[model samples]
Target chain A: MVQALIGIGIVYIGILIVLSLRSRREIKSSTDFILGGAKIGLILGFMTFAATLFSTFTLMGMPDFSRTHGVGAWLFLAFSDAVMVFFILWFGFYLRKRIGQQSFRGMSSLLQDCYQNKGVGYLYFTAAFLFLIPYVAIQIRGVAIFLLEAFPDFISVGFWSVLIVLIMLLYSELGGLKAIIYADFMQGTLLLIVVWLVAFNCLDQVGGWASLFEKINESNRALLSPPGPKGLLTPQFLIASCIAIAMIPVTQPQLSTRLVIMKNYKSLLRMAVAVGTFAMLIILPTIIIGLYGALYYAEESTSGFLGTVLLQEQHPIVAAVTIIGLFAAAMSTSDSQLFAMGNEFRGLLGASKEDQLTPVRVAIIVFAIAALLFSLVSSDELVLLARLSFSGTGIMGPMIILGILSKKPMGSFMIWFSALALLIFILSQLNVVPQNIYSFRVDLALMILLSLGAFINYRLKK
Target chain B: MIKNWSERKLKSTWRIIYWSAILLIAVTFSPIVLIQDKVDPHWLQMPFHLWVSILNTIVLVALTGVGGYVFYTLKSKTDNDQNL
Candidate 1:
C-alpha cells in the first residue's frame, strides 16, 4: 500500500506539471492569471470549487472532534447554519454578474455597494487577508506533516511543507489562476480516485456496514453508539454542515471567482450542480475513514500514523494512505489560496499589477516559511487554527448577507454589522464572564438580523 | 397602482408563505412544546446526529425545489408578462 501510494503520488505530480506547461501560454497578464481571462468553464470551475472545500481539517480535525463528541459532533457541522443553499445558487449568478470587468480586489469593492459603506468593505477585505495567511499556513503544514508521517526519514515535516509550497508557488507564479485551475483539475481527479479507493478498502477492512456497526456497538453501547438511541447521525450538526457548505460558494473568495469567469446563467447553474454534487460525494471516503477511526483506533493516539504505524505495530496501511490523501487535500487548498491571495494582494500593494503578482507569490513563500517555523516551534496552536480561522466569514455571514439582501440603503449599517460581528468573534474568543454559548450566538444573531433589516429597508426605499 | 392579476398573485404568495411559516414553527417546537413530556431530555438520549441529517436533507431538497420553481416559473412569468 505504501509503495503504491508513493507511485500514484509521483504520477499525480507528473501529470500536473505537464498540464501546467500546456497552460503556460495563457499566463501573460494578471487578469489571464487570476481570473483565467474570465473564460474558466464548468469543469475547471467545478474542480477548483471541489478542491478548495476538501482540506486537511476535514480529514484530521473532524475525526479529532468526533472522538470527543461522537457522531453528534458532526452535527456541529451539519446544522446551526441557516443561509441555506440559496447563497450557493445566488452567489454563482450574482457575483458573476457583479464582478464582470472588475479585478479580484474590485469584487471586494462591490461590498461597499452592498454594505453601503466603503469603510466596511475595506474592513472586511483586510480581515479576510489577515485571516487567510494563518489559515493557508496551517494547510501547508498539514500536507507537510502527512509527508513526514508517510516517509519519516526522507523528508522532515518542515522540509516537506516548504517543498509543497514551492510546487504551488512555481505553478502559481507561472500562470496564476489559469495555471492553478489546470493543476486543480489534475489534483482533484487524484483526490477522487484515492478517496474512493481508501473508502472501499477501509470498509472491507471493517467487514462491511453490519460488522462495522457491530464493532461500534461492541466497543460501547451509548445512544448514537450501540446502546445509545441517537445513532451515529446528528440532525442539528447536519443542518450546520449544510449551511456551511451552502455558504461556501459565497464566503470563499477562491471559489467565488468562478462566478466572474462563468459565461452566463447556464454555465453558473451547471457549475453549481456539478460542484455541489462532487463536494458531497468526495467527502464520503473521509467520513467513512473518520467513522472507521472511531471504531478502529483511539482518537488522539491516531492523530497521525507515525508512532502507531511505524513504532508500535501496524496501525493500518489504509490509514497511511488516508494520511497522504489528507496531505493532498491540504496542499491543494494551500496552493490555490496562495495563488488567489497573491493575485489580490499583489494588485492591491504592488507598484504595478505585475509587481503585485510577484509580491503575492513571494508572500506565499514567506507564509509557508513562517508556518514551518511555527510548526517546529509550537505546532499545537497552528495545527488547530484552520477550523477556527474558517469562522471569519461565518462570523460575518448574517450581517454580510443582510447587506446583500437589504431593501434599504445601508451605508451606515455596514459599520454597525461589521463592528457587531467582530465583537461577537472577539467576545467568543475572550472567554470572559457568562462563558456561555449564547454570548457568541446572540451577538452573531443580532448582527445578522440587524443587517437583514438594513438591507430590506434599503430595497424598500427604492 | 398594481393590477388585479398582480394583487391576486401577491395575496396567494402571502397565503402560502403564512402557511409555510406555521408549519415550520410546528416542526421547530415539536420536541419541546408539543412532545416535551414525551421526549427524553438527556445528553444520553439526544438523537442530535441522526435527526439533524434527516432534517438537513429535507430542508436542502425543499430549498432547491422552491428555488427552481421561483426562478423557472414565477420569474419567467413576470418577465413574459412584461414583454407582452
Candidate 2:
C-alpha cells in the first residue's frame, strides 16, 4: 500500500510540475500570473470553482459528521451550497458590473475603490487573514491526519503537513494561478471518482442502500433523523450552517476571485448551476460512507473508524488511490487559499507593477509557514473549524454586497463598524465573549446588524 | 410609465420565484418546522426527513436548470438584437 501510494504520489507531483512548466511561458506579468490571464471559459471555470469550494473537509469531515450527526448532514452542506449558488448568480452580476465601472485587481482593491477609502481594503485583508489562515491550516491538518492513519510508520503527520505545503508553494511559485486552476481541474475529477467508488463499495458491503439504512435504523435510529443521536444538527445549528455556507461566495476571497475571473456572465451562470449539481453528487457518497461507519464502527475513535473504513478494510490499491485523492483535495484547496493570500497582499501593496510579483511570492511563503504552524496545533474538528472560517469572514459579506450594489460611495464609518463587528466575532470564538444573544449566534447577528447599518448609512447619505 | 411597470413586473417575477423556491426548500427540510419525527412511507429506505431533503434537492436542481435556461435564452436574444 505504501509503495502504491508513493508511486501515485510521484506521478501526481510529476503531472503538477509538467503543468507548471507548460503554463510558465504565459506568465509575462502579474495579471497573467494572478488571474490566469482572466479569460477562463465555462468548463475550466466550473471545475476549478467546484474544486476550490469543496475540499478535504468535505471528503473526510462530511462522512464523519453524517455518521455522528445523522442524515441532516445533507442539509448542512448540500442545501446550504444550493442557497449559496443562487447568491453567487446575483452577486456575480452585480460584481461584474462594479468591476466594469472601475477595474480592480483583487477583492481588497475593489473594496477600496468602492468605499473610496484605503482603510476598508485593509480591513478586508485583515478579516481574510484572520479567518482564512486557520481554514488553510485545517485543510493541511485533515490530510495529514488521514495520511498518518493510513501509514503510521511512513513518517510523522508533521512531515506530511510540511510536504503538502511545500508542494503547494513550489508549483504556485513556478506556474502561478494558471497552474493552480489546471491542477484543480485534475484534482476535482479524481476526488469525484474515488469518492463515489468508495461510497458504492461501502453500500455493497452493507448489502445495499435500502438495507444499509435499515441496518442504521436498527442500530441507531437517531442517525436517520434530525440532531442525530448526538443532537448536533438542530434547527438553529443547521440554520447557522446555511448562513455561513451561503456567505462563501460573498466572503471567501478564493471563491469570490473565481467568480470574478470567469470569461463571461454566461459562463458564470452555467458554472453556478454546474456547482449546484456537483454539490449534490459529491455529498451523496459521504452519506453512504457515514452510515456504513455508524452501523459498524460506532464505538471506534474517529481516527480508528476512518482508518478502518478508508484503509484497513479496503483493498490496498483502493486505499492508495484514496490517499492520493485526499492529497489532491487538500492541495487544491490550500494552494488556492495560499495564492489568494498572495493576491490579496499584492492588492494591499502600493508597489509598482514590476515590483509586485516578487513581494507576493515572498508573502505566500510566509502565509504557508503560518498555516503549517497552525496545522501542527489545530483542532481535529475539521467541519466546525471550516464553518468558523466561513462565518468569521462572513462579517464582511454585507460590506462587499453594499460595495457592489450601491451607486454612491460608502462612508468610512462603515469600515470602522465592520472592523468592530469582526473583532466582536473573534472574541466570541475565543470565548472571551459569549457567542449567543437571545438564542441567535453571534456571527449571524453581527452579519445582520452590519448589513443593516450599511444600508441605513447609505440611505442617510443619500 | 407603462413600459417601466412592465419591466419591473418582469424582473420581480423571477425574484418572486427565487424566494418562493428558497422558502419551500427551507421549510420542507427544516426539522424544527416539519418532519420533526421519523415516519413511515420511506423512499429508498430513507427516513422521512432524509426523503424530504432529497426531494428538496431535486427541486432546487430543477430550479437551477430553469434559471440557467432563462439566462441563456435572454442572452442570445440580446446578442441577436445588438447584431441587427
Candidate 3:
C-alpha cells in the first residue's frame, strides 16, 4: 500500500508540475493569469466549473452525509446542484454580456464597478475571505485526516494539511488561474473514475443495489426514506439548501469568474447543461457508498468507516489512486478558492496594474497559511461547514444579481445590508445566535431579507 | 416564427424562458412536486423520496435542454439579423 501510494503521488505531482509549467508560459498579464486571457472554451470551461464546484466535499463529505442523513442527502446536493446548473445558464448569459462590455476581473471588482463604490468591493472581498477561507481549510483538513488514517503514525495530519496547501500555493503562484483550471481537469477526471470504482466495490460488498437498500432498510428504515434517520433533510432544509447552492455561480468568485471567461455564450450554456448532467453522474456513486456505510459501518467513527471502505477494502493500487484522487479533489477546489481570495483582495487593493500581481500572490500565500492554521485547530462536519460557506457567500447573491442585471450603480445601502447579513450568518454558525427562526435556518431568513431588500431598494430607486 | 419577431419580442421570450425555467427548477425540488413522508408506490423498487429525487434530476435535465434549445435558436436568429 505504501509503495503504491508513494508511486501514485509522485506521478500525480509530476503531472501537476508539468501543467503549471506550461501554464506559466501563458502568463502575459494579470488578465491572462487571472482569466486565462478570457478565452477558455466549452470543454475546459465545463470541466473546470464542475471540478471546482464538486470537490473533497463531494468525495468525502457527501457519502458521510448520505450515511448519516439518509436519502434526504440526495435532495441536499444532487437536486440542489440541478437547480444551480440552470441558474448558471441564466446568470452566465447576463454575466457574459456584461463582462464583454467591461473587462474581466474578480467578482469584487465587478461589484465595485456596479455599485460605484470601493466599499462595496471591500465588503464583497471581506465576506469571501471570512467564509471561503474556512471552506478551503476544511477541504484540506478533510483529505488530510483521511490521508493520516490511510498512513497512520507516518506523519501528523497537520503536516499533510500543510503539504496540500503548499502544493496549491506553489502551482497557483506559478501558473495562476489557468494552472488551477488545468489541475481541475485532472482532478475532475480522477474523481469521477475513482468515486465510481469505490462505489462499485461498495455495491459488490453489499451484494448489489436491491440488497444494499434492503440491508439499509433492515438496519434503519429511515435510512431508506426522506429526512434520513437523523431527520436533517426536512422540506425547509432542502429549500434553504437549494437557495444557498443555486446562487453559487453568482456569489462565489471562482465560479462566477469561470462564467465570464468562457469563449462565448454558447459554450457557457453548454457548460451549464453539461455540469447538470455531471452532477447527476458524479453523485450516484456517493449514494451507493453512503448506503454501504449505512449498512455496515453505521456506528463506526468517520475515519474508521472511510478508512476501511475507501482503502482497506480496496486493492492496494486502487487505494493508492483513491488517496491521490482525494488529494486532487482537495487541491483543485482549494486552489481555485484560494486563488480567488487573492484576486478578490487584489481588486480591493488600489495598487498599480503592473504591481498588482505580486501582492495578490502574497495575499494568496497568507490566506493559505491562515487556512493551514485553521485546519490544524479546527475539525467540523464537512457538509455543514461547506453549506455554511455557501450560505455565507450566498448572502451576497442579491448584490451580484443587481450588479449583473442593472446597468446603473446600486445603492451603498445594499452593500451595508449584505455585510450585516454576513455578520449575523457567521454569528449563527458560531452559535452566537440561535441558528433558526420560525423553523427556518438563520441563513434562510437572512437570504429572504437580503433578497427583499435588494428588490425593494432597486424598485424604490427606479 | 420567432425569427421574424422584433428584438423586444425576442427579449421578452428569453425573459419568459428564464423565469419559467427557474419556476420549473423550484417546483421539482419544492414540496409541491411530492411530499417526503409518503413511502408507497416505489418505482423500480426505489423508495418514494429517492425516486422523486431521481425523477427531479431527469425532469430538470429535460427542462434545461428545452431551455437551451429555445435560447440557442433565438440567439442564432438574433445573430443572423445583426449580420444582415
Candidate 4:
C-alpha cells in the first residue's frame, strides 16, 4: 500500500514538473504569464476554473457532510454557485467589450477604475492578499495530509504541503500564468476523474439512487429537507445563504477574471448557466461520499465521516483520492487566490515596479508558504478556516454591488462594511453573534442590511 | 414549413426542459449543498449519499439548457450567414 502510494506521489510530482517546464516556455510576455497570453479557449478556461473551484475539501468534506447533515448539507454549493452564474451573466459580455478598450485590467484595477479611488483600490489589493495567503495555506496543508501515507516519517504532512506549495510557486514563478493554467487544466481533469471514481464507488456500494434515498430516510427523516434540525432554523440561514450565492462573483477572485478572458460578449449568460450547472454537477459526489460514510460507519463520534472511511477499510487508494480531492480544493483555491492577489498587487500595491508574472509567482509562493505555516501553527486545517471564512465572505454581496456602483469618496464605507461583515460572520461562527435577533444561527442579515444601508448612504452623498 | 418549424421548436424544447429540471434538482438540493448529514433518514433503507447525485442532476440540466443555448445560437447565426 505504501509502495503504491509512494509511486503515485513521485509520478504525480514528475508529471507536474514536466508540465510546468513546458508551460514556462510560453512566458515570453507578461500577458502569457498572467492570463495564459489572454488566449484561453473555452475548454482550458472551464477546466482551470473547475480545477481551482473543486478541491480536497470538497472532495472529502461533501461525503462527510452527507453523512452528518444529510440533504441540507449541499445548500451552500447550490446557492453560492448562482452568484457566479449571475456574475458571469452580468459581467462576461460587458467586460469582454470593456476589456477590448483596455489591454490589461485585473479585477482590482477594474474596481479602482470604476470607483476612481486609488486608496480604496490599494486597500482592495492589500485586503485580497491578506485574506488569501492564509486561505492558500489551509489548501496546501490539506494536500500534504493526502500525500502523507505515501511518505516515511521523514516528511511530515506540513512538509509535504509546503513542498507542493513550493512546487506550485516554482512553476508559477518560472512558467508564470501559462504554467498555472496548463497545470490547472491537467489537475482539474484528474480531479474530475477522481470525483467520478469516488462517486462510482459510492454508488456501487450504496446500491444506486433508489437505494441511497431509502438509506437517507431510514437514518433520519429530517436530513432530507429544510427547517432540518428544529434548532437549525433561522431567517439568518436563508438570507445568508442567498446573499452568499449572490456574492459569489465578487468574493472569488478566479471567478471575476473569467469574464476578462472570454472573447465574446454573448457568452456570459450562456457560461453562467453552463458553469452554474457544471458547478452543481461537480458537488454531487462529495455529498455522496459524506452520506455513504455516515451509513457504513454509523460512528456518531467520527471526527469526519469521510476520514472514517479510511479507518474502516484501510484502503489507501480510496483514501488517497479523498485526500487528493482536498488537495485539489486547496490547490484550486490557492492558485486562483494567489493568481488574483498577484494581479491585484502588480498594479495597485507600492511594489508594482516589476514584471507582473514575477511578482505574481512570488506572491503565490509566499501566500502558499504562509498558509502552510499558519495551518501548522494554527488551530485547524484549511477546510475549517475556509468554512468559517466563507460565512464571513458570504456577505460579500453588498460590497460588490454597492462598492462597484459608487467609486467616489467613502473608501472608508466599503472597508467598514467588509470589516463589519467579517465580524458578524466570526461572531456567528463563534456562537456569540447577537442571539437576541435569533438563536444560534450565525446570522449575517443584519450586517448585510447595515452594509446595504451604508452603500445607499454613499450613493446618496454622491 | 411545419417540418422546419418542428425542428426549430425541437431545438428550443431542450431550453425549457433543461431549465426546469436543473431548477428542480437545484431546489431539491439547496437544503443540502455541502452541509454534513448527521444521520440517516427513516424513509430509505440504504446508506448512500444523494447530495452528489442531487447536485449533479441540477447542474447537468442547467448546463444542458444554458450551455446549449450558446452553441445553438452560434450555430444558427452561421447558418443564416451561409444562406445570406
Candidate 5:
C-alpha cells in the first residue's frame, strides 16, 4: 500500500507540474491568466465548476455528516445544489448580459462600478477574505489530518498542510487560472470515480441496497428519516442551508467567476445542467459509504472511520488512488479560492492590468499562507464549518444581486447595510451575538432583511 | 405580425417555466417532502422521505433543462427579430 501510494502520488504530482508548465506558456496577459482567457467551453467549465463547489467537504466531510445526521443530509447539500444550478441558469444570463464577456475584472470591481462607490468593492473583498480563508484552511486541514492518520509515522500535520499550500501556490502562480481549471478537470474526475468505487465496494459488502437499509433499520432507524438521532436537520436549518447554498454562485467569487468566464451562454447553461447531474451522482454514493460507516464504524472517530473505509478496507492501489483523490479535492478547491481572492484584489486596484498581476500574485501567496496557518488551528467539524463559510459569504448575495440586476444608480445604502449584516453574522459566529433572534437564525434573518432592503432601495431609486 | 405574436407567446411560456421551477424547489423543502418518521411507501428499498426528496431533485433538474431550452428559444428569437 505504501509503495502504491508513493507511485501514484508521484504520478499525480507529475501531471500537475506538467499541466501547470504547459499552461504557463499560454499566458499572454493578466486576463488570460486570471480568467482562463474568458473562453471556457462546456466540458472544462462544468468540471471546474463542480470541482470548486464540491471539495474535501464532499469527500471527507459529507460521509461523516450523513453517518451522523442521517438521510436529511441529502436535502442539506444535494437538493440545495439542484436548486442552485437552476439559479445559475437564471442569474448567469443576467450577469453575463450586464458584465459582457471581456469587460469583467471581478465581482468586486463590477460592484464598485455599479454603485459608483469604492466602499462596495472594499466590502465585497473583505467579506470574501473573511469567509473564504477559513474554507481554504479547512480543505488543507482536512487533507493534512487524513495524511497524518494514513502515514502515522510520517510528517506532522502542520508540515503536511504547508506542503499542500506550497504545491498549490507553485502551480497556481505558474499557470494561473487556466492551470487551476485543468487541474480541476483531473481532480473532479478522480473524485467521482474514487467515491463511486468505494461506495460500490461498501454496498457489495453490506449485501446490496436492500440488505444495507435493513441492517441500518435494525441498528439505528433514525438513519432512515429526517432530523436523525441528533435532531439537527430540522426544517428551518435545512431551509436556511438551502438558501445559503443557493446563494453560493451569487456571492462566492470562485463560482461567480466561473459563470462569467464561460465561452458563451450556451456553454454556461450546459455546464449548469451538467453540474446538477454531477451533484446528484457524486452525493448519492456518499450516502452508501456513510451508511456503511453507520453499521460498522458508528462509534469510531471521524479520522478513524475515514482511514478505515477510504484506505485500510480498500485494495492497495485503490487506497493509493483515494489518497490522491482526497489531495486533488483539497487542492482543486483551495487554489481556485486563493486565485479568486487575488483576482478580487486586482479588481479593487487602480493599477494597470500589467501592474495588477504583480500585486495579485503577492496577494495569492499571502492568502495561501494565511489559510495554511488557519488550517493548523481549525476544528474537525468540516461540514458545519463549511456551511458557516457559505452562510457568511451569502450575507452579500442580495447586495450583489441588486447591483447586477438593477439598472438605476443605486445609492450606497446597501453597501453599508450589507456591511452591518456581515458584521452581525461574524459576531454571531463568534458568540458575541445570539445566532438566533426570535427563533429565527440570524443568518436567515439577515438574508431576508438584506433582500428586502435591496428591493425597496431599488424601487425608491428608480 | 406573426413573428411578434409568437415571440410574445414564447416569452410568456418561458416565464411560466421559470416560476414553476422556483415553485417546485419551494415545495420540495416544505413539510410535504421532508416529513419526519414517514418511512413507508419505499421506492427501491429506500425510505419515503429519502426517495421523495431524490425524485424532487431529479424533477427540479429536469425543469432546469426545460427552462434553459425555452429561455434559449426566446432569446434567439428576440435576437433574430432585432437583427431583422
Candidate 6:
C-alpha cells in the first residue's frame, strides 16, 4: 500500500508539474495568467468549475455529514447544487452581458466600477478574505488530518498541511490560472472515479443499495428522513443552506471568474448543464458511503471512520489512488481560491497589468500561508465550517447581483447596507450577535434584506 | 415584424421555464417533499423523501438544459436582429 501510494503520488505530482510548465509557457500576459486567457472551452470550464465547487468537503466532509445528519444531507448539498447550476445559467448570462467579454477584472473591481466607490470593492475583498481563508484552511486541514490518521507513524498534521500549501503555492505560482484549470480538470476526473469506486466497494460490502438502506433503517430510521437523528436539517436550515449555496456562483470569486472566462455564452451554457450533471453524479455516491458508515462505524470518530473506510478496508491500490485523489481535490480547490483572492486583489490595484502580476503572486503566497496557519488550529467539522464560509460570502450576493444586473449608476446605499450586513453576519458567527432573530436565521434575514435593498435601490435609481 | 414576434414568444417561453425551475426548487424544500416520519413509498428501497428529492434534482437539471436551449434561441435571435 505504501509503495502504491508513493508511486501514484509521484505520478500525480509529475502531471501537476508538467501542466504547470506548459501553462507557464502560455502566460504571455497578466490576462492569460489571471483569467486563463479568458478562453476556456466547455470541457475544461466545466471540469474546473466542478473541481473547485466539490472539494475535500465533498469527499471527507459530506459522507460524514450524511452519516451524522441523515438523508436531508442530500437537500443540504446536492439539491442546492442543482439549484445553483440553474442559477449560473441565469446569472452568468446577465453578468456576461453586463461586464462584456474583455473588461472583468474581478467581482470586487467590477463592483468598484459599478458603484464608483472604492468602499464596495474593499467590502467585497474583506468578505472574501475573511471567509475564503477558512475554507481553504479546512481543505488543507481535512486532507492533513486524514493523512495523519491514515498513516499514524508517517508525519505530523502540521507537516502535511505545510507541505500541501507549499505544493499548491509552487504549482499556482508556476502556471497561474491556466495551470490551475488544467490541474482542476485532472483532479475533478480523479475525484469522480475514486469516489464512485469506493462507494461501489462500500455498497457491495453493505449488501448493495437496497440492503444498504435496509441496514441503515435497522440502525437508525431517522437517517432516512429530514432533520435526521440529531435534528439539524430543519426546514429553515435547509432553506437557508439552499439560498447560501445557490449564491455561491455570485458571491464566490473563484466560481464567478469561471463564469467569465468561458470562451463564450454557448460554452458557459454547456458548462452549466455539465456541472449540474456532475454535481448529481458526484453527490450520489457520498450518500452510499455515508449510509455505510452510519450502519458500520456509527460511533467512530470522523478520521477513524474515514481512515477505516477509505484505506483500511479498501484494496491497497484503491486506497493509494484515494489518497492521491484526495490530495488533488484539496489542491484543486485551495489553489483556485488562493489564486482568485490574488485576482481580486489585483483588481483593486491601480497598477498596470504587467505590474500587477508580481503583487498578485505575492498575495497568493500570503493567503496560502494564512490558510496553512488557520488549518493547524481549525476544527474538523468540515461541512458546517464550509457552510459558514458559504453563508458568510453569500451575504455579498445581492450587492454583486445588483451591480451586475442593473445598468444605471447604482446608489452607494446598497454597498454600505451590504457591508453592514456582512459585519453583522460575521458577528453572528462569533456569537457576538445571535445567529437567529425572531425565528429567522440571521444570514437568511440579512440575505432577504439586502435583496430587498437592492431592488428598491434599482427602482429609485431608475 | 414576424421575427420580432417570434423572438418575443421565445423570450416569454424562456422566462416561464426559468421561473418554473425556481418554483420547483422552492416547493422541493416545502412540507410537500420534506415530510418527516414518512418513509414508506420507497423506490429501490431508498426512502420516500430521498428518492423524491433525487428525482426532483434530475428534473431540475433537465429543466436547466431546456432553459438553456430556450435562452440560446432567444439570444441568437436577438443577436441576429442586431446584426441585420
lDDT tens digits, residue span A266-371, model 5: 8888899999999999999998999999999999999999999999999999999999999999998999999889888888885465345888899899999989
Q: Please identify model 6 stretches exceeding 4 Å from their true place.
A: A351-354, B1-5, B79-84
| Fnat of every candidate, listed in order | 0.10, 0.38, 0.46, 0.11, 0.57, 0.64
Model 3, A125-205: lDDT tens digits are 888888788889889999998998998988999789878888778888898899889889998999999999999999888
lDDT of model 1, residue A112: 66
**Candidate 2 residues A114-165, lDDT tens each?**
8888988899998998899999998899999998888789899899999889
lDDT tens digits, residue span A1-462, model 1? 566566656776676677677767766666676667766666777787667765665555554445443544333443222223334555544454444444555335556666555576566556556556667777676666556655668967667766776666676666567666766666577667656765676678788855654565557335242112333233332333334444545555665566666655555555555654564455445555555666666544543532333222333545444555565666667767665555545544533555345565576677656555554543533323654455555455555565555544455654666666566665665665232355334333543455476566566554
Candidates' lDDT values, in order? 0.53, 0.82, 0.82, 0.57, 0.89, 0.90
Clashing pairs in 2: none
What does the interface RMSD come to for each candidate?
Answer: 7.8, 3.8, 3.4, 7.8, 3.3, 2.9
Q: List runs of model 2 lying over 4 Å from the truth.
A: A101-103, A351-355, B1-12, B29-34, B71-84
DockQ of each: 0.14, 0.36, 0.44, 0.13, 0.49, 0.54
User: Could you tell which candidate, 3 or 5, scores higher by TM-score?
Assistant: 5
- Per-candidate clashes come to 42, 0, 0, 63, 0, 0
> How many Å off is the CA of A386 in candidate 4?
2.5
Give the chain A TM-score for each candidate.
Answer: 0.81, 0.97, 0.97, 0.83, 0.98, 0.98
A1-462, model 4: which lDDT tens digit per residue?
555556776776677678777877767766677666765666666766666665655665455545655555555555456544644543443444334546454656766665565655655555455555556665665556545543445687667766777666665676666666666776666666677676777778789867766776677666565435443422345446555545545665666666566544444445556566666767766666666666676564333344445433446675555454455456556767677667666656433453645555666666666676776765433344555445454445455555555535445566565656555655655577663354434445555465667657676767
- TM-score of candidate 2's A chain against the true A chain: 0.97
lDDT of 1 by residue, B1-84 (tens): 123335457456535643553454345324432221122232232334344433553454355434433433433344332211
DockQ of 1: 0.14
